[model samples]
Target: MRRIRRMLVPAFAMALVFPAVLPAQAAPIRATVKSIEFEGMAAPASVKEMADQYSTASLKVTYSDGSVKTFPLSYNRLFKTTDSIGGTVAGVAIDHKGAPIIDNSVPANPTPYVSDSPDSNSLFQVPGMAPSALGGNALSLVTHYEYITFDNANQSAYGLIPASMSLTTLDQNKQTGELKPTELNKIDFSGVNGLWIPCNGSLSPWNTHLGSEEYDPDARAYEADPKATFISPFVQAYYQDKTKTGNPYDYGYIVEVKANADKSTQVAKHYSMGRFSHELTKIAPDGKTALFGDDGGNTMLFLYVADKAQDLSSGTLYAAKWVQKSAANGGSADLQWIKLGHGTDAELKVLVDKGLRFSDIFETSDKAAEGFTAIKTYPSGKIEYLKVKPGMEKAAAFLESRRYGAMLGATSEFNKMEGVTINEKDRKAYVAMSYVEKAMEKDAKGADPADDIQVDKISSGVTYELDLAGGAKDRDGSAIDSAYVPTFMSGLVVGEDLAKADALGNKAAVDKVANPDNLSYSESLRTLFIGEDSGMHVNNYLWAYNVDTHKLSRIMSVPAGAEATGLQFVEDLNGFSYIMSNFQHPGDELLLPDPLKIEVLAEINKSFENRKAGGVGYISGLPSMKQIVEAAPVIGDDNPTDKSLVDLRAKAAAAGAKLEWHGKNKDIVVTLGKHSLTTRVDSSTATIDGKKVNLPAATQFSKGKTYFSAAIWDQFIKL
Candidate 1:
């Protein structure tokens, strides 16, 4: 075989490829990055958690040519400010007059009270996001921010939101996919009685931000008296209706904000999806199916199926029934969904406008009585017994959803199930069991009617994965309308609970996820980004877990006492990829012991303006191939490829293709890959291997040099 191969190549062509006499050089193989990997960030020691913690971010970039290289990666914080919407820091907050709202009420600690930024940004899949009217890169966006006043001296925050969900266009460097906030304008929520406490949100399949309102006001309170103190916030600050009426039905639903090219937005609170303390709403890979976990205790796993794709205005809501499979590892369950009811958002708005009370849908009693069916349910995980009124099942399903779900025997064992995300390639979904305690553990933390989930109370928490399938049925054995439904769920990543506190007063293992809250999964990278909202750790961390490798790496540590929030991993935004992260309410972890808080509070407070702002930022090292490529070609882009060997020789070296002297006839051989060209330096024609080809220009012999004008120079690339 060796002799046979040696005979194939004109032996002369192998030697003197780049002689000392020639200025041109024979090319060697080039290396380009093919993959990247990182190591976990170190846990902060003691008070170091009070400051931002970045891991020793080292990158392993593997190239296509099988070469390897390493580099140090760093976090490029986009912005972190308590500054009001007059500038671009985070998502802005605007008021009724469409001007930035400067809520400097708390003179000691002042910052923009920015809520949830969507999981996906405006730069994502820009071609699909581009409005047909604005077919190019140019587009406009307006923003509105809802704000709360933090009275730091009093150690309490004002709960009332002056405005609702803010909408704004992000300024992005189209080439790099860098997002910068600009201006903000309030989205008038008078149609929905003003937006509630807009919390962590997700980006919809149709490019909309699906936001949440944590801790819905108790409808029963409003049922007893329409002038409840909780109702005053909206009436006084938002509606300004001195009449003093707040409709409980109007708040606590999934809010969608759709941006348009004209800088206008269409916003709606989807009542059909059921009202609960929504943590975050994640749309399934199938687009129409939506899944979310209620943020409070004794809650139920919720799923919403839209009648049409990319439409959330109307849908059928379902609650999960947990059939326990194990009592270990955060527990496993075969999930059976119970169909609740269906309705249109528009229709629900009509009912909300009518000011429907809880009493209108169900009759309640302190104890079990005639015609009153008692069921262990909620005032948020504790227990409330109620009966459904006749002919109000549908209304009860939407307006008083959790109550109706409990009455129907849905698993009310889930407590503080925070974020839901999916890995499309594996057909699996993940839910963050922020705290593996209370209702999830049998009789633990005094959770009653503990029928299902029974696991050890691990304060460090666990992230669970659900096996998804296309065809699914409810507890009644009725067909579910959509694909993307979870059939079974098991713990994917569980944190370690320590019996004693660490040096940093950490109750959970420092290297593991403590009170895992915000989660974002990148399908392309096969990684799940987990954020912490814990009292277990002195400082919350953001972690990256690779599904294939089963490697967990701590990528970042937010300020002490701050909740790691706004976690979004974008696989591709134009030409780059980014791991988005944010922290809120720094120096506000009331969960820690007073002593620990006292030690760290002052330092964490100093991290921001008067120590108020939690940050809004992202990791910056990851970039796609398109992002890393050169602006110009790797070879001769300035001169046409159809040039003489003299002109092509210079580019040949850059392209990593060989230029060789061949044969006794003074022919030259240019080899790129498997193909090569052979021609006399003084001939006007050439032969690609053995095929004859004509040259556009005649070859010439200059002083001490030979040139061949071959239009076929470009053909070498194609070959």
Candidate 2:
């Protein structure tokens, strides 16, 4: 056998000489296409053919001796440029089709991912990039890094930047005294802009993404005039099409992106969704009706048509009236849907009778709808049996009032809603809150101490499913579809759970029902994950919610020193799922060094004296636990007298409080009776009003139970 095998090897090697021995190969590349290069930017095109996946236009490989092989661009992966072939083509930005076009100036601003400047203050220094590099001030914090403002003094709403250029950062957490490993990357989304900042959005069945522009009065206008003034969130788009500035009256609406298309294409706003701080919207799988949450502090949950619907001028817009015990105990509430109408139809009757406003109710409907004819716009006439109850007449009337006074309190109840999504397959809607916590600090004795106050530590992220059918009932005692003002749909939920307290402040029951925050769902996993506030090491985590068992399980915990803020699933080119999260810096636990090493550190000082680990305490109003470690002050002897606390103290003073330093370097502890806050600070000399003060005020104060200190970074107060 061995001798035969040795003979066969040479025979097999020689057989390759035969022409038939070779298998058919890919057709040879033929055309000598000249490379087209953009001086400042890379071409938007990518190689589409399998053979050109890795080959670049820079390579001069001889493909089957020039068979006129033309390299084309196709979709490959998320956050990557297309492969280069033997020769590059001018990355032609096209319309919906693959044709080359001349002018490609849609929302033409250069993406924010590229640093506007390369200063030390630039986001690139943070080590972890932000969510959107283009985001302005407040948006810059979360956009640049995963940061949680435990103290509420710095809270304000901001705009969303495009996804392409996400700014990331590395931050030193104050609570855990840990250096969070910050790894950052930038993504250049082609043809994308005006991302709805960290708001709840929906994914369309067509694989596109839809979100609402939570534009305020400054960024948008909503007056009654047809030619109203408007501002473009995109600087480039704003400058080029000054004429198209939406009339203040024309702004609020849902915008849709064909995710599969080039990011540069101008997204169309479905004006049919109406003008308002259009918060969260979920399109039905059929793509007709849209369910929305109006988050201008407190407004009604609105439902609208998607332009394709017949009704444009008029359609049913329902205000949800939660029918529960206080209408405020969160989930105990139900919803009541009421339709809105333009009352002056009576005058239209007069016009039909004596001829005043118009000849008929539908007469000027055409004229009223003729305004926005850009995308086949038309107004739907008043449909009968739309059913506005006689009792809800006043409420529904005010909702439709163009009068500012009438609508003041009409919708101010729904405030600060953060997330919204729809399980299209289940016909359910979900909404959550980006909880706000405020800390208030003040001097305990004289002006010697600093103003260190924190308040509103409430964590809010709850998911409520909506029922499409209005809650009204039919004649046979069956629940009526009209009664369905989208109520909390029964299946999904998310967020932190508060620990129930008894009268004695002892642990009562687990406050499971009240505190589920930051909910995200995966249809593929058949799991709904909630971001919960885990005490000590991990401030918050992603917990899985079982729809069948109604139990919460820890799927994967957040790394130490990092709290999972934004949970988004981006489908990469390979069809794999990657989760995007904001890791707040100076995280609770120690952060491992760069190469992706992570460990959740337990609190080393968990002694009986530092408050026993029984249950979490309340920060602001939300439930939270004392973090194991304290964040070290970023200030030092060299950078002493830094304006770090100057603005903080000023802001607190304006809000009715004053601050002063308590300690010098040792962990400064602020004790308020039994409650205490501790952190590390650096030594510094201060000259206030030409008065030079040595070290922190803590050096002067004797031990006292009632006195608190603001030394270094952490503020501590007497219990």
Candidate 3:
């Protein structure tokens, strides 16, 4: 669904007011912005502007003094100020020079601190810190705890069934209304493969999540094709089986997990989709054909799986073929399906043994060329794994002597391919890529070719939209749609005009591309959201492109530390809109021989006959929040310290607390443990600096512990 951005509301002379029919508010909750306090600086001037753009109403922020400031609220989740009292903030604001700003202010431990201004460059210096504002304390760094949610019948384990519920609301706490928390439904999804990276992925037409594994697999020679050495990294399988290496190559392949299960043992693999680094998947509006992108650094290709569900076993996979030299050229490509017709099991075994590396021949030809390059080899790129093997003690030695060109392998036509989407209304497939500046070296100037690629190189994420006409046909020896193609083969086409137009489109696209990182279509919101990857130290952001406006603007950044990865628009039990992040949780596990497997036939048989008689045989998009919330008790503080409350209140104050840097080094430290105050319960009286002050129960305390650091300053007392 396309999410309507507030900006698209053309400044109407009159505002339309519908009846106050907010989806039934199950709770008596209200968000009131009490007051605003500034530390080093006053509220940003843009705060008011932001409120006007996204907030439901102008925020009335009263200061300790008699002054007041007003501003608009951000409609986007990344920008929305809600229930959370303390969390890292990362996102692009109109104010921060279009760079992501990270605010790590927590009220419980208020210590005003200032650090270096990070851009795209210094972000990755700290492993977990690169994505979020906090240098080391990122959310993805936390362990993936097994959490359960409530279902209509009872509690069910996650990954046991594809959750098919519409989300009603997303509170500030980050919990959705329908998917409830419970204990009985605990299930381990990390069978063997490990915790899947939370790249907010897409639900395919066939009900499978297009999740991408983020780990670089232990190198192995899975495909022994002497003809090919490199392979796209995506593969199909539940990450249950552990190997000396890891779950197959990072190459792209579709893995299906069936839902509507009666018993376990439902997961299965459909090896038809070709291998490549996959970002996301989208099917034609008709739901028969599928399109995906190869997000590898080398020349990547766009893949098509025709009739994927029923007969992808022998269908075509095509790469876009752009015309080389045509002024009238629109950068479009004739779909060229790879020519590896269904091979014998022996040939398939040979292809697999040759190492999943794509054929070097295909790489050499299309890597450097623009539109409609002929595919004489398997994958049109270089195979870099020919020299490296998992157990080879001499693998490093073999790599050192190899020619750089040979080692570097063939280049495909694109840079870093990322997101994929289909404009079914227009019958077009859109492939997106992150544009890397070719001129920049790893170091700023000449430190070292191998130094970490510097922070800034000018990145603009772009998308390519293709038209699949003539039944995926193109001239110039490019393969058109055909069933007798290899899983990774590009479809061949036969129209000179198609090739020329496709090439022209590819070139033109480079100029028009924007820096938007991730893309997804919201069936409910009826909009497309583009997310930014954490580039350099810049915080990744979320941007929404209004189909009506045709202009994209910064919506919000994902919370600090979690680089926006996969995006799927999900409806909650309350029918609210939510975008899930396929976060790469650190402690996620990979177990062997996953035990929760469901038998697909067993489950389907029970539902099939009833479903045939109009039972619908499916899970509802809406969930029962009452049952979920009931199962989940109001969690009390886990800390033994009643001081937890003290810390919470103190931290809340600190969040609004502001202090300027005072140290000569611009590095100052503030300690909370150093200060001790006494407070009464009823007509509370607190002594600060030996002075007595009356405090109300409502008065937020400023004491927690006694520890502060060189980086913090003073805390604001929110009396």
Candidate 4:
């Protein structure tokens, strides 16, 4: 079934009214500006090395005054070996001591974050500038959380493996959004016990990088068997100390990294935000309210509202209870938040430094014992018997949050809750469900707690839309501090599973998304972009869905067995448009032990090229931002269409200027209204009455009339 939507007007132009009907085509093959439309390159062939193929995109923008301008952009992949066509190239790995893993004679060190590992989240900085700004460009810092670290040193649990996070300085051509790498440095993570699979990330409201550590080794599982170094190779490699188990509590929190003016970084692990497979965190406009998605089966959703603005060091954490309202199509539910004990990062870090154990915070049993809470399935689909010990609730909330929330009755019914992004203009948020099976569906094995999310299994997965609102009171009747509180969630896009596999061994529909991962939204464009991390598709795709039009367009696709990630949009970067994305683990085997995996691997081998380094890239355009602001007055609009014989008075208003004409002909008196008498307009020169000025353009007229010429106006704005 097709979903219909209304025009999501941008905040900048609330007064502008759109037509009653928008374009009906889901996605077109052409680009048009009158109405927003962009049909990117054709999808790659099934068994092709599609990574080498490039695409072109066009974006037509409509301004507050109803002026229209179109921007054309080029899309391509980036590697250490490749020079950036538009922006900075990524894919370099560094050690804790800040040395490149592999030598780079080339500008971009091709050593992937961890050799042969996937490069995860990418953040491209573009700060808004003032109108009167002059000279110089603002250096944009491109940051990436290298997913994992490995080299010749170690590939197994017993070997030494420490990951890295890199920050690259890219001086931008604001007018074009083109970038040139200036300096590259690694953000040291030794202070935080090192990052574990630093996965997805989001830009904080105050312009910092908010990232996560995903799929941390189970803390309780480690407690049961201390010798199981295979369970946590990261701990064994990073810590290596027989005396220290390497605190599991330290490895799964929101890690914040800030790059300073000197290319130095400030790194902090926000332990107050709860520990789990934190896929990512998105901060609302208020800055205090943060929504974090846990990536695993039977997971929980968490919300953290900071005690103060722009500070994640301390916050009040809340877990979600899925109050199912429907059973069909991945299930619709009203979210009820459970208040969990809060702690500051400073306090939580102390407990972690003391090497707190799972037994210290919670008591467990195979079956329900006296004072023990009922057994609840963990996010990994394993049933866990948990009972938060008295005086340890605060510790459990930060150390073993998913278990603590489940003990408190917050529903752990979600599966593969991956990525999240908010559309403040629409007061809505989007979440990616990589898979929609397991605990979310009916249980075959008998269980104690009831299944709140009993629904059909979806191998391809579902993407949910959550409604955000203000003035939402909590379960305890106290007002939630966040204005952007999520109230309900429903499947906005559901992927269909086919009984028969496709020609390329794809189990899901090609048109619809399979295993949607990173989600990013552009408020100005009213578009939600999605990336895929799927085993169902032989080749994963990147998509752009117009919220106002409800048209989902397959914009680009990656090579076979690759995970498309970090789909972010910059609607206006100094009047230029940018849509950035990156893919990783190309040519890897499709996840499984099935015969179909063998067949798919054989087909992928035909066009796939294996690389020792991870893949990191983006799609972009470049114009001089410094040039745009300087030319605003003379150009009027970004793409000015002033007539050949434009009237002097009419041209001034179009140039965003306010000027009054008192006299006409050779006796013309032009005043800025503030000046009693400034200058008089002549046939080709300005005569100073009170102020002296120069008129560069001579008078020209169409149909025997005299006015200013439109030619050469591209570089001037008469202030």
Candidate 5:
């Protein structure tokens, strides 16, 4: 085995190559901070005082070759009062005649509101609305899903930003911190409201961005009067006619957005996937199977199989059941998929069009008993049960997916299913379970002790890998026997000691990952990037774990109050692979800040507090896979031999070049601009525009695939 000495270079270096041998055991890769850069104007004191305004920062990487590049970052502008649309920044008021009036006027060019409280003072005031119902004034922005077009003619990258409307502020008494009942404002994005709590999303195989709308209006209220349900008086006034006819049913679904080259967007919501507090949605390689994770207590893992590939408008949704194989916590479980029923978006839309409310599906009196409705015995010694009532309308099943799953007997014991990422090559999906509490005691009551399969202990979170290719048949004609194992478990906090944290959060440690949230994997690097959304860490950090080496390195730390999210691997046209991420909502004090010595704090106060300045921004930078594994003399069998070419193809695409191979000529050709390089396999000699040149490492064929050496990349490719 050869050892590679990795050296850190300056921030502007184009590349940094490690000496580790490829396909062989290599030394652990360590992260070195090259440089931190800031963009956009400094947030105003008013914005800084607010809990929502987190600063957006972009990271620049200097590769081993000294080529420096930065990932592009952008923010969405808020809907202003002066906008021509009838949408109002302030809340709406109902007149004496029972008509809603929107106050769309800008208040004498009012300055941004400053407040002592961490919540923003900006208000969307509705005169006739109750103050308790006024929502916060900040534009809701949360996740970013990057869509890359692979077309050579129109290669582009578009970032789809979804506003997660999780929190809103009604009027509050400044001195007493009490809710003000008279004046209230309902927050609305543009003129369109009701996009509450957009959560993590995925880029579909068709290149569309799918954003999940998490959380819903008060379920009880909606169930009572779905036609006139209002989360707040302000929301009631703002929604007006929509709420009058049961519009709450229209909000909690998955939205699909397609970005145009001009930076414009076309958006639509996929109601057929079912309405729930969706944390993540991943489309499998087949493009027909979509796995969804619900982010809440007593949630169900959903599977949606589209009627057509690349089309999610219509689908059959199913709830998952975990048949416990072991009683131990975080142990393996055999997954059973139970069909929750199916409906097309158009079919479901008819119900909404006909003023059907969520309450129309199931009886409100039965809400407390909404789990595992029917039990069926199978001949194969397997028993199946319906989590939800069987006779509910399919439209209702789509509208109230969580409830439907529950009534169909799906396991609702999983807590906070955060992120889902699929490995195309392995045909497996990785799901992050933010936390697992002991099985539902309510469901366990009066049930057979042997039949209860829920674990007995609590866990911070565990990443479970589901085998996509394997499954068995259940009596209901559904697939069972899908095996899942815990791959990563969050570190535990004990005795208030943060420094003693361990990988599984079973022990305390200062640098350990607490709550693992957003996840992304790099095939070329064989590494998984995990982002922290935990309060255990003073400053949530982003980490990278090598799948092969089992090594985890903390790469970046978010400022105070922000969680690390939107972890993505993007290949630019220049052949560089960059990690794009964001620090969401800093300065809110979700967790205790790292203890700072008085002297150090005083000294830092003289400059500025990075943590105190909160605003959303992009952070990108990381070495390419080829550079990390170039040092070893011999490649190992575990590493793919064609890894270099795979990376080269990404680089060439980024660089506006075409990379292809001519089997007849046994040559690899890369054309960029007016220059071209043609290297023949097994030949040290090559031709650059027909001029003969000696190659450093001859291209070799292994396992029926051509493998290009790092020397070819370093010597021939300009990048």
Candidate 6:
């Protein structure tokens, strides 16, 4: 008989309606005339746009108050190199002072070509330079992070853009027999292996940038040539026992960088937090608890509780287990947290120092039969045990966390769990799952046989909200209970017939959202911003969803072959908000239209050829909250004299509040937070929290939507 797992949906009634039913021809959401628009700023041009048609002028933003401001947004090309502080090319030459020399006159040597060599021009070429083993074109690619600072004294804003140097190699000049050094771009951070494929990151409460290293140290490549001295020492030392298999274990961890512009930035790799294909980290309001999402199939969601507030160097790591309580795909589940153990770097290093191999912690078949203690039972009914070998437990738990978690009964069954955002006020976290693959769907079904799991065949993506409130807590208010119910928000879906087109044309059946990968929430805007990283859209977009109004709007989009990433909202001292985002790998051939007319393809390819500078970083301004409210649509009956009450009901629903209408008493009551507001129709006053407060407009009602002044609506809701 097959074992059945039980599933549950937490807070099922409050689930947001999925946008899958939206019409394909729905108009793009836009701001009305009352909202401010940035003039002279041209909309993003498609690959088909002519070179001359591109706009290069600074964006002129016109605020609702008629104040005009200009933001000079442009790409910063400076990045650190071994010989220089700044350079345009991947390889740079420095002057005597160690500053980058912007000289293009160096004679190009064509003889004895080293460009094809994977190990050429690496950092190892020069002794005493930054120690890095990365090689090839990986060294040339520079990923950047943008930092903004506001000065209250001058009422001005400043920006700091630092580029993370990709992997590098040492190349020998055959003609001169001299070694060429390929250095890193940003080096203010000390004691860290250079970043490779620096993916999405978050700003910590201590005001620092935490970047993730995605897909590092190809194990097979290292195994193919184990004698290479350029291999990272961490990889070489950590996997000494597994060198034959080439399973290097040093890569895939979070790197923290200081965000202070006034001081030199410091960098540290939090290896104790566990290594995996890290997507991003969202720290809770308490500053000690953090939620980490991994970006790969069969991965796991990790939780870390720091030893102290605002410090991530030491922590306890745990893997999540989803106890099925319901059958709905992307629905809620009773979350169980399985402890994988904890330790500081100093404590864990003792085990590493003891020469314990990573594979030693696992009980072999021969050893398992010898009666080792069982750690946990796997889904396949296999029993895992802690190896009897001394000093192996802590090392394996820290170095191979995913495996250790599995031994401890934690589920590692997620499919590309990407970005995560936290709402401090609500104590909820929204996690983005890029796709519901076949295996995850299977796990959901097999987890519970009592209910049927409804999973879409052509899965797009989903955003799940995990409730962190009212859980079993410890002394410090950290949740010790593993049971958490997550509400699912289906923002993108693909139908069967349109699946092929959606894949080839990179278009979604409904344009509201597709393949959401990165998310950020702004309390001031009362909106959640979603950035797409997918091939299911012709041009990936950054959408803003007003949680209060339940309105979705496309605020920005990228060119073909590009996905919007690294979304951050920064408010200046003057109360103006700007969105900082990056466009990764644009103008790729794969982004072209499939089965298009030959002429159209020719035109598009020609345009793309001339504009193939793929990646770019941008900072765009936003409209004020009043402007957004003014742009919102108002509904009422056609009757001229019929007064309408503002649709407080809709607002209540969006805010997750309760609304009570007293028809006979001609009054409406709204309950939110610890306060209750009661008002009568055609009244200019309302009682809030049992105290009379002035209302912006008289309450009115109509056959259609209830109508009220925007001022009154703002007063009643947090928005």
Model number with the top TM-score: 1
TM values, all candidates: 0.77, 0.39, 0.42, 0.75, 0.57, 0.58
Tens-digit lDDT track of model 5 for 1-719: 00001001112212333432232233322222232222222321231222232324333443333334553332322221111122322212222232334322244442211111011111122223332434422111123211111112222111111122211222333332222222213322332344444557766766666776665443435555543333433244334433433356666677775543322345677778887777658787767778876776566778787888888888778776766665444455677667777788887777766766544565443222445343311110112233323465586478767655555666666666777777666556777665544342224554422233455443444566677664545439755323222122222111123345433222323444556777776654555666666655545555555554444555556544456655555432132344545543344333332333232233322322322222223333343434333321221122333234434465567667888889787678888655566666677545544445444456666665655555445434442
User: Compared with the true structure, what per-residue lDDT tens digits does model 3 show for residues 1-719?
Assistant: 10001011111111112232233322211111223211111111231221111223222233222234443333332211111113321111111121211222343543211111111100001121222222211211101111111122333222221111111111222242222111011112332232222222355555443443221222323334311221121111122112223223322244333332221213322233444444445665545466655443443344444544443333443433332221111223333442222212223333444544422222323132443222111133332323233433121211111111123322244445556665454344445555543311233554221222222233443444555543433334554443222121111110011122222121112212234445665432334555544332112344444444354434443222223443444444233334443221111111111121122222322432211110100111222222212222111111122221234333435655322234454322222332323333222333332333332222232342322211111111311
RMSD list, candidates in order:
11.6, 30.8, 25.8, 10.0, 16.4, 15.8
lDDT of 1 by residue, 88-192 (tens): 444444444434444455786664444322222222332334432213233333222323435333333333545455444455566555565555445666655
Each model's lDDT: 0.65, 0.30, 0.29, 0.63, 0.46, 0.47
Q: Per-residue lDDT tens digits of candidate 6, residues 1-719?
A: 00011000011111111232234343322212221222223334443531111223233333222334453433221221122322333322222222332222234521110000010011111222333233221112123322111122222111111124332233323322122334334333324423433457777776656777554343323444644312343232222322522234544577776522222346777777876667777777677777876776556767777888888888887777666555354655766666666778666545444544434555444334554544322112233444535656666666667656665656666666777877666667777776655445654534421122244433566666677743554323455533222222332222122435643365455455666777887765455667776666656666666555444555566555555665765543122345555554344334444444233345534543322222233343343444333343321111223333457778878888898888888778887765466777777666654445445567777775555555444534531
Predictions ranked by lDDT, top down? Answer: 1, 4, 6, 5, 2, 3
lDDT: the better of candidates 1 and 5:
1
Q: Which stretches of candidate 5 lie above 4 Å from their native place?
A: 1-193, 218-220, 225-246, 327-329, 364-391, 438-453, 456-459, 470-475, 478-508, 590-614, 623-719
The weakest ten consecutive residues by lDDT in model 5 span 1-10
**How many residue pairs clash per model?**
12, 109, 144, 12, 59, 28
Winner on TM-score between 3 and 6 is 6
Q: Which model is ahead, 1 or 3, in terms of lDDT?
A: 1
Ten residues in sequence with the least summed lDDT for candidate 6: 1-10
What's the alpha carbon RMSD for model 2?
Answer: 30.8
Kindly provide the TM-score of model 4 when superposed on the true structure, using C-alpha atoms: 0.75
By the lDDT metric, which is better: model 4 or model 6? 4
